[model samples]
Target: MAGALRAMAGPSAQPPSAIRHPPSAIYNSSRPMQLGTYRLIDRLGTGGMGEVWRAEDTKLLRQCAIKILPANLAADPEWKERFLREARSIASVTHPNIATIYNIEQDGDTLFMAMELVEGEPLTKLIERGPMIPLDAVRVATHVADGLAEAHRKGIAHRDIKPDNIIVSTRYVKVLDFGIAKQIGGTTDANLTQGNMVIGTPHYMSPEQAMGRSVDSRTDMFSLGVVLYEMLSGRKPFTGNAVTETLLNIVMHEPVDIAKAAAGITPALADVVRRCMKKQPDQRYADCDELRTALVKSLKEDPKLARQSRIPTIAVREARRLEPEPPPRSAVSSHPAPQPTPAPAPPARGTRAHRALVADDDPATRYILGSILQRYHIEYDEADNGADAVKLLKNREYSLIFVDLLMPRVDGWGVIDYVRGHRGNVAPRVFVVTGVQNQKLSAADQDVVTALLYKPLDIAKVEQLVQKSA
Candidate 1:
């Protein structure tokens, strides 16, 4: 796994699959694992099904991607055959925007499939620059939509479509990881696990997919709609404290309107996203082709979109363009411009109703929150654990409380229940803070808490929350 991921930072390209050597050769790995003739150079990415590696096809003398299942999976004969059958079926797909599968091979217990090594950053990383410039986002989506259209034509439905699975290079966008793609009219891989369980990540799955309902190309469209929504909003359409909670949100709620979520996005672009995200498959574009056509047509018809597309990278617009370069300084003033005077500190938390509290096992986290709150002229108290937080809440009322979800005793949830259950009318609004992944909030926490923020907090959003509370 280490060797495979090492290759992701350096992706090398070769000629297309049309001109590649004939397959099959057996070779064991020495230092760098080698299966058959394809010497595993590095691993590119991994998922629930399998992990992909960057390999050097010694016979073809070209670089390619090889996906391999876990050794434990080979013991299950039914699963092994299903993997091979699915790999062969997925290999049939061929498109510029889609990674081409080269060959599937079994060496001892190791089963692998060689494929195209996409040289670029995942859209997930690209989005960290903040919400994308709308046009560049649409252009990237159009490329993926084109690939989906082709797959739909071949009677294949890519069950998983997320920013993590899509690559965006300087020149082009490529869709990847077809391991979960199901054949339209054949044995669908809908329920690989017991009790007819649905496969695919929750953050990007359609409501129907989340509910274990039959999915078609429109299922992929719904996922694509989520990716587009994230690209424009810097956040997924549906998110909760836990995966099950997220799925419930997807099935039961409509996302906040995109226009209100992000500035600079036009009504036309927002409408297109809304249409693609309609919970019912019937409400969405009839098919991938229709979705692709709508995206392209929208891009052409909107003048604002045309100008935005010319910018190329989405991050550039967000991190740079919208703010624009500052004017050249007037050759340093003879006397520095009068220094602004600092404002006087306000009174302590004990004196006001706007008092806030920070609860965490770590003093450093509590300190950071204290610093931010202080700068905002908002006085706040501190609690080292959930018990202390509950004690403070029981005795007094506060305007806000930032508490860690995981702690030694009576964790974040304990404090939340105490305040909501005990304090009721005069309880402070809760702001959950935690480093723990897969944290699930109680129903009462949702109603009582103002928001849930992960550890290594987003300073800007926190400040906004402070201002909102103030």
Candidate 2:
């Protein structure tokens, strides 16, 4: 539950008041701490906001996270108000991508807020593993932008949008800990004061934020850009040996080009990152929604994400379905009940509409590649092995075939030979996918394959190839 309910930053540097209350009754109890209807099962974490507990609601029998205000802070009206403000900020918006706030309750001196207990690793942990495949990075960024767009629409700006505040689950991503979120155009408060405190993680702060200028929705975009850059390169865009140096870098430095940082990242994707991290807020994406669109357009699907992310294929399908469909034109039935046109034969090679065949023994690869094709409204079929692919090719022609070089039964070489030898005129463009690094194809393979792509495919490159040929 600590993974689910961890809070932002640690306790404040400000000293505790002279009159400290006795050890709270909530913790002193031998049994699990009971705060009204909630049974606090265990302490999850502690931060400046206070302690987080994994709790169960007796009435609903549902698991929840309880963020309790520190006893010392609860005694101070200003701190108490700030804690309540965080709760209110989260409660104002109900979105699938944003964590949910259930209710605010007080148990005598112990005040707490109940919320959804998210189950996932933090984006920080994912980044620690290594740079994510570019497609996955964009997919996560798209979800984050979507959540931010909703919050922005509600006139709230998540002042702290960093990897530590994002949770990535198999089913979906959730933006967490809006403790520092501010309502756009709202009156000045504690956050804006200079020297006393600097809001947000320094490496992710926007130039405007670093200089203590007013902030709006665009501030979040800059932070998101830093995050996306890290996801693609496994490095923060702005960094320093010290906090002040980092802040100065944010204020005045240009980050190393993403392409140089991470090889093979598509230009279109790198541009999206560039636009997002523009020093001036006005120069960044107009809004998070626009950023989300750019992110989706930059790439299609990642094979690794498909296999490991656990994000359902339906999510991609539904996202693609967002494009407006042309309305059906009125049609009059003819008098003689004209026989429906015979199901048209599958289009011949090079004559087909956007259609593809994916042949791979790995079901995960087939699933993801098919999902990408589906997203682009391309018709496609799958074959687990090369022989089935050859059989399918014999009956139904496809404009594109993505075949693994190695497979059970007939190998890719056989499939290529069948296509090259039998197909008289127009042969489907065949792309070879293999796990071998620095693989050197023989002269024969060079003649047969349209292109050779290594394993853990670069999805953007795949998308570009598909768009150009399919």
Candidate 3:
């Protein structure tokens, strides 16, 4: 896998100077494990599916990644066929953004696959810090959509399109892992397990996929929408505590408004995500080509993005535009100007009973609540997490509070504990606002909150809550 990944780093299949090399321990210098014309040098990773190794093609004088079926599972005929299916899927398509399969070989009873080495981190790693710049996110999505367009044209539907399966190479955005790819309108790969169960990653599964129904190219589009949403918002659109709950969310719920969830994103770009995630496959773009076109148009319309038909090496860090130099130290003014007086504080909160606090890690949720609070002429304070909400509680007493159940540092439950712990004659009304469903709130949970409001919060209900509290 390391060799294949390295080849993907650039045209030369070498890691860029900026990328750090793996630990020396990752490479085995003992004795080269030879198979056919390839010498395995490094163990990249291992999973339930297969074990990947970085190998040198002695005959071709090139490097690639070899995926070996685990010895334990090699005897299973179904697993063996599925392993071969992955190779066929990759070999069937040839595109700049799609990883290539060079060969599939066997040594005695052991079978392995040699594929193009991609020397870049997965998209999942890139998004770990936070949401990406909107333009860059759009660029990556557009490139991925373009790749899927080609695969779709060849009648292959990549059922799995999560960020982990997409590599952000120095020269291109390459989609990897076609293990679950299904041939459209084919009977062999029906997207089901032995017991009529669905075969797809839970978080990104489309409605049809969640239901274990027949899927087409539209399924890929839905998964892509989930990825794009995560790229823009730094979070998944559908989530729950358990697998069944998550599947339920995917099948039954609408996600928070993207325009509201991700700040500084255009409504047009959000609309593309919206349409792609429609529950019905027929309601989505007719094909990936249409989806790619929409994303490209969005890129062209974004004034901040450089006008280009093709995306540059996305794995490369964005060059920060240097700030303009401050007017060369003015020789005439040796001393700094005196600071201005601070503005007066607002009216005392003790006299007003309509003050509120909105605490949620998501900027979009805060934005929505803040806007709603303003409509009712109620002053409010915003906290990005629970700890900050606690700090705000100490200074002022708000009549109402809207808090998300999950947050960084201290979660929403902690905020409720602080509120309930420091009980006063005039207790503040705490509302649990979140995307997570808790239809049967425990007695303790119900005691702390006045109400449990689900996400995509109803504007009318919010307004009513504010008006009544005020």
For 1-470, candidate 3 gives per-residue lDDT tens digits of 32322222222211111112233312235433997899998888754346688999999999999987754455777666767888898899999789899999987666889999988888999778677666667767977988999999999999889998888843468998887788999988565353233456778888877766788999999999999999887889998765566677888889998876676566678889999999998899999888877876664443233222123223212221221222444468443211211223243235535588999975545766776565455688999889999999998888888998788889988998899888566667789887655556678768778987775455446655665565
For all predicted structures, in order, the TM-scores are 0.58, 0.63, 0.59
A best-first ranking of the candidates according to their lDDT comes to 2, 3, 1
- Candidate 1, 17-36: lDDT as tens digits: 11111221122233248889
Task: Write model 2 residue lDDT over 317-361, tens digit each, in one string.
Answer: 333344233334327722211112223334545455446889987
User: TM-score for model 3?
Assistant: 0.59
The superposed Cα distance between candidate 2 and the true structure at residue 417, in angstroms, equals 40
| 2 or 3, greater by TM-score | 2
Per-candidate total of colliding backbone pairs: 4, 0, 9
User: Largest lDDT belongs to which candidate?
Assistant: 2
Relative to the unseen true structure, what is the C-alpha lDDT of residue 380 in candidate 2, on a scale of 0 to 100? 87
lDDT (Cα) of model 1: 0.69
Query: lDDT for model 2, on a 0 to 1 scale?
Result: 0.73
Cα deviation of 193, candidate 2, in Å:
5.5
Model 3, position 93: C-alpha lDDT score: 98
Clashing pairs in 1: 4-42, 4-43, 5-43, 42-54
Question: Which segments of candidate 1 are over 4 A away from where they belong?
Answer: 1-32, 78-82, 194-197, 306-470
Off by over 4 Å in 2: 1-32, 190-195, 300-470
